[model samples]
Target: DGQKVTVIATDYTCIGEPVEINVIVSDLPNAFTPGSDGFNDIFGAGAELTIFNRWGQVIYEGTEGWDGKYKGKKVSPGTYYYILSVFDANNTKTTMKGSVTVVSDEK
Candidate 1:
């Protein structure tokens, strides 16, 4: 969703023109490669992210990012479900659920 914010300044006898700002929230990537080549090595969406495997088991949870690992081991390349929670500028929390695929460039 797109939201707009307006700001204005006023004094005892004067008022400045109002300014409009657009707030745009970006969507997380559908996939990432944890190969550590400095590109797409970590996946994250918000301040908190919880990822689960297809079997409904929690695989990863943290604020930092997921390196496609579980229990310090790299998970197989595949799709994983995730729940992301984030706070906006006003500290309003929003939660999102989606899937993200883990990719590997290694042979």
Candidate 2:
């Protein structure tokens, strides 16, 4: 934990900022509401997420993040697969794979 570091450099011609690289899996809910209730919302930015159905069909392709909707319609509750590729300020990429369950408890 906390094993990441940021480095900054500068020169007489220009000033440089620290490089930010964080592609770790966030502790997010297995399911979330796409209604924008100001809670568990979109995934982390600076990443490309290719979410797939159980049949291995691509359902959503998000370059920044996902809002639990595919083609402007809320998806149904089910188990889904995802392949997340995160990019840092330095253009370095990190990939991750996991599954999430979508559920709703509303009328």
Candidate 1 per-residue lDDT, tens place, 24-68, comes to 575789999887688888888336999999998999999898889
Residue 107 shift from truth in candidate 2, angstroms: 4.1
Q: For model 1, what is the error of residue 75's alpha carbon versus the real structure, in angstroms, after optimal superposition?
A: 0.1
lDDT of 2 by residue, 28-61 (tens): 4566555557765665344678888899989888
Off by over 4 Å in 2: 1-29, 105-107
| Per-model TM values vs. the true structure | 0.77, 0.64
lDDT of each: 0.85, 0.70
By lDDT, who's the top model here? Answer: 1
For model 2, what is the alpha-carbon lDDT of residue 84? Answer: 79
Worst 10 residues of 2 by lDDT: 20-29
